[model samples]
Target: MATQHDERAAPVPCALTPREERRSDLVDALRDSASVGLGAFPMGVAFGVLVVHSGLEWWWASTFSGVIFAGSLEFLFLGLVLAAAPLASIAVTAFAVNVRHVFYALSFPLHRVRGRLGKAYSTFALTDEAYAVTAGGAGRTFSSRRILGIQAFVHLYWAGGATAGALLGSALPAEVRGLEFAVTALFTVLAIDAVRAGRDVPTPVLALGCALAGRLALPGQMLPAALALFTACLLARYAWTRYTRTPYARTRRGGDHA
Candidate 1:
């Protein structure tokens, strides 16, 4: 019963959409995330080089990249986490900013995933970009190999890029200082692509509405607020559909597909 993610182009529903058995587009997407890491790490390295003159070695930055797994938020919170930001504040911020994820969980049909690890990693791989790819419905693969591969690819890319930047930051020039801006630009394009999809209208609207509601009602409770709004709407829609079915006219109306 396994289907390839790439086979959606055809109605047969057996082939995965990964293009090839071995290649991964998820890794390809990391080209952007990697650029962000490389650009930022060099700056951090430059700072370390200037202050301590030896440059950042490792341990700290790599751990941050691996564990934190967020780019902008990681940059902003690295210092704060090291400083005194309450754990609650960090949690609140994460929830509020990422509240839209709750909506994503709605349409994801994981019923076909086979084992515990497959399901676990599939959910784990569901990052912002991963979710975009999934909800974008690029290729429907019942086998999660490519999906999990994508996550692993991005994870490796981040670690490698950060390590490279941290080590080379001091030796790099100053004009390349703001390269991190490219990641933001890339994501802007991704956002535009997602908006143009047309099919995502319902999801995005629900996400935007929940976000607004969270800003007003929950403020710091982004995750909970988003979940509440999305759940309420989903439940309401389900109830309406369940209770209000239109009776089909038995008489010939349009005489066809109607």
Candidate 2:
């Protein structure tokens, strides 16, 4: 009877332990962040080299990477600082450069993150690369732990690269001609990947149109003007889609009733 009962018993389900789950999350985050890190590290090294060439101490690279964490803005800030620009001018420039982040916030999955501190850090670390990775289709299903881990890894890559570059800057050639292009190259690659993944030609076309319009109309304020025009166009598209869909939906319902 005991042998028969054992044969009839259900098999136990296996589950990952908390430690194992955390390890898995870390691995996934590292894998996902590798591409971004590749770009960020070199860009960081370039920034550090520029800092030393610009006569700033090595520590300034680390400080900017850790504190500001905005790649493009950091480069601009370095020049502004060297020129002794007014604080108000710096603040305005910072706002204009980073205003696109406001749109990023609309779609970022902050609610999935657990702790208050985690959310705060996530918000602070929402770089373009991070947003691109986390807002992509594959990233939509990622856990909060994985998302945070990816950001942390990318931050480390930038910080470490900056420190290394600062140490090596004194030995390198003064010109360092092509290092400045790393960030631009990285952005181009990211934009290409985004276009391929989305397979949406019209969006890029719309963006290009807006950019041209901004350049022609508001040459002095191209970035902000382009962003504003693109945003308005997107909003208009959304409203039109909703309006068209509502009547169709109601028509379908009415047809079903008839």
Candidate 3:
């Protein structure tokens, strides 16, 4: 048994200064988020430009970026708001478009975030790019500070770029013909990059097949329907693979035991 004085005398672990911890977290976060920030900035600028040209007030760009902070859904909101769609319609559409984020939360490293403010911001900034950056080898083990920093930086990139574009969009041509396709182009690039990185032919095949089926079955609700179908397909594939592999895995285990 140690005396109270001896226990008190024992060395305690050195705690990092708040500033030093923040600096370390910022540096790591910037390193991980730089690519996503770069990509999002240009897209955000495009969005702001589109918003200004759509006869909406310039402030709408900042408003949407700050409030929605959703890339694809923000684009759709432009048309919906412009059309003055029913509130119910907008609500449903927004949910359908962003339902994927609900799934994203299931695997996002949210538990690492501490404090109400940190967790709230983490949840708010849980974009696709953020998820992509922090879902793998080194990212999975990142500290809460680093995770929060990455999310903050990415969020800033979008908000800042949108504000800049809103300011500049007035000088551009009034009727930009192909601006709407930028979102589609961005997704196309992302898809190609994912395929290249994964080399997973079946996923893309399933995605394409589901998208086509959704378009054919319900053209107006294609995106949501396609996502639903794709999810089901993926789940089915997972189950089938697990079922088929378990027997072989058991046999290999038995052989090793023998």
Candidate 4:
């Protein structure tokens, strides 16, 4: 009985405890990631089927799942690989394809991440879904370990689902069409949640603007070029804030500096 009680009372197997603040953060992250992951998993299934059709072996698809990890890029590069495109061209294309991730990386709260492996895993698992999860997670403060858990769960879910899809691709052909919209719906809910949370509208609006601008201006290279544009816009916003400032408090509202 003592041993059983001790086991039940054992440490949480993580750096951060499930305190009030941390627990809330974890819940938020889970909610955020779950939404995004639902949408992305279908893409993984499609990729799994593509893996079989492209003459690549199981490990090929699984490796792409584990390493490359980005759904759109994986789809594109798989096509490129099948077409026998030059590696250099593919590398350039992949860089441009996944470049928005660099901005995401920059925005991620790296300070909360704890140890080396935790940080590395957080970096490695930095997918759109994972980012949504981490960003939406309810924590006011975080440790590296907590973030790693959030990230790792999403990453593993993605890869595991991909692998399962690839392996069972033949058995589940009927599940293809309708099931594929999960990832889209997931992120849609997250976007709505963000808006409903009423914490910040600028984030989604800025993202939307950048996306629209990139689609209009950059087209094929939207990811990289838009990221650049977004960075510039953020800098410009900062400059405006620092110099002219905005009306927030009564002092600023009265046309005086706060």
Question: Each candidate's TM vs. the true structure?
Answer: 0.57, 0.81, 0.72, 0.76
lDDT by residue for model 4 over 1-258, one digit each (tens)? 235434334445655434554666667656545656666666676778778766777678788988887777888888898899999999998887777887786557776887887777778778887776656545325556567767766776677777877887766756646776676677787778767775666767887898899989979887777778878887787657656755334344444543
* Model 1 CA deviation exceeding 4 Å by range: 1-20, 23-56, 84-103, 109-115, 175-231, 246-258
Error of 3 at 191 (Å): 7.7
Give each prediction's root-mean-square deviation over alpha carbons. Answer: 8.6, 7.0, 6.5, 5.8
Q: What would the TM-score be for candidate 3 when compared with the true structure? A: 0.72
Scanning candidate 4 in windows of ten residues, the lowest lDDT window is 1-10
Tell me the number of clashing residue pairs for each predicted model. Answer: 13, 0, 0, 13
Give the whole-model CA lDDT for all candidates, comma-separated.
Answer: 0.57, 0.82, 0.79, 0.71
lDDT of 3 by residue, 1-258 (tens): 535554344333596555666788999999877867767887788888888888788888999997888888898988998999998999998888887676676568888888999999888888887887775545668999999989888888888878778889988655445554644655566567667766778999999999999999999778778878988998788667756664335445333432
Candidate 2 lDDT: 0.82
Error of 4 at 51 (Å): 0.3
Q: Please name the candidate that would achieve the greatest TM-score relative to the true structure.
A: 2
Off by over 4 Å in 3: 1-17, 173-223, 241-258
Task: Give the C-alpha lDDT of model 3.
Answer: 0.79
Off by over 4 Å in 2: 1-13, 174-201, 247-258
> Which candidate model has the greater TM-score, 1 or 4?
4
